[model samples]
Target: HPKFDMVMHDLLVLLKPKFVVMDATFAMEGNGPNRGIVIPMNLILASSDLIAMDKLCCEIMGIDWTDINYLNFVDQHYQREEAEPQIIGEKIEDVTQKFLLPYDDLAVRAQRWVYKNYFLTRLCFGTPFLNMLQGCLNVYRKVDEEIMGKEWVNKYWDNSLPR
Candidate 1:
């Protein structure tokens, strides 16, 4: 029931893990992390700092950095916020490209409205239908690229599929 914007902050406060790694090789589009259309991206990102990794993930996902909750939380709590994380392996540009945002502007705005004005999140967490809907929306999320696309899918994606 948590919003995407808040996930990073929540993770930092709760988990405080030593490392964070993100696999965006086959990320989702449209509704995502659950129900969105999956796209072949071929990317792997890692960082010692959770905030940095989450920010990078948002960038690759085409999510506005300003709108992400965890990033904001980190900036407020951690010093040297702008310092870039050390890139131990592939650079971001080489491995990834911009993908579509999960939802249209209208839907996003509406969701934000519900979150801010209607106290919908409280209800959503308790209700089965809302929970299920959120689950479906996020169903395609956190999935392996291999599951979403074939080995050759990335090569032929642009030519064969709709953007």
Candidate 2:
């Protein structure tokens, strides 16, 4: 699964932009931007450092920065030990409050249970059908590889096959 901050980092790397703005007016909590509950907040955040912006967003949403995997990964990878982010626009204490976490504790527990169970995933994705499809694709690839390896087959069949 792609983390939010990692996606943002990749975008920044590709675009090499000067600044980033994030809308935290309605942000997610507990389980996230998609699946979690949306807390109505009136907040706007911006930063040159995407990681700091993400950390600030999480903080505004009442998420513990340590619990967020993306921030942890960035900090570890970059070895940025002293990268303390400065808030410029608004004071955190004045704007943010403990918004409700998306799902109740019981729902979160159930979701975790379903996620950890192998059978649940298999059932969702149809394991046997997927296996069969993968097997067929592998067989086709092997046949193509063998045919391409033979000099005569390469000269003849290469003309027939689509590039």
Candidate 3:
């Protein structure tokens, strides 16, 4: 939660974008922002308000906006009473589709638990630990590719994308 909050809120304060737009035509589900199943929704979302945009995205995905940790933090920090955002295009209710979330049931609970716990957050995000954690993940990815084959490695990884 610390890392997510840092990136979502704190970093935004330092480096705010002029606008935010998301391609929701095919949204990812299950352990997202990484490996996940894609669902076709045929919609595009855009807003100057990042928080509002994100909340609407979650709603369109048929998930509770509050279920996301960073969103909850933003909601509280901003003192938001309602989750409604001004709709400029398609109505969210008309396009809502339930997406299968990431991780097993136990893993989901464990993830939430870790995010909510201060001790766990410190252990995961403190000082040089985050860098070390990233390094470990990199090593794991290399090992996974070698063992499982490089089917997921993109042609663009080395700037060899087909024109």
Give the winner by TM-score: 2 or 3. Answer: 3
Cα lDDT of candidate 3 equals 0.75
| Candidate 3, run of 10 with poorest lDDT | 76-85
Model 2 C-alpha lDDT per residue in residues 1-163, reported as the tens digit of each score: 3246577556655776557897778766656655767767777777777767777766765778888777786666643335577777678877767766556577567656666777865653556866786889999988877876576666677586688
Candidate with better lDDT, 1 vs 3: 3
Model 1 vs. true fold: TM: 0.54
Whole-model lDDT per candidate: 0.67, 0.68, 0.75
The C-alpha local distance difference test score for the whole of candidate 2 amounts to 0.68
TM-score of 2: 0.51
Supply every candidate's count of residue pairs whose N, Cα or C atoms clash at under 3 angstroms: 12, 0, 2
Give the higher-lDDT candidate: 1 or 2: 2
Counting only residues 3 or more apart in sequence or on different chains, how many pairs clash (N, Cα, C under 3 Å) in candidate 2? 0
> Per-residue lDDT for 109 in model 3?
82
lDDT digits (tens) for residues 104-133 of candidate 3: 667668767877888886686666787997
Error of 2 at 67 (Å): 1.1
TM-score of each: 0.54, 0.51, 0.59
**Candidate 3: stretches off by over 4 Å:** 33-35, 78-84, 104-163
Model 3 residue 4 CA deviation (Å) reads 1.2
Which candidate ranks first by lDDT, i.e. highest?
3
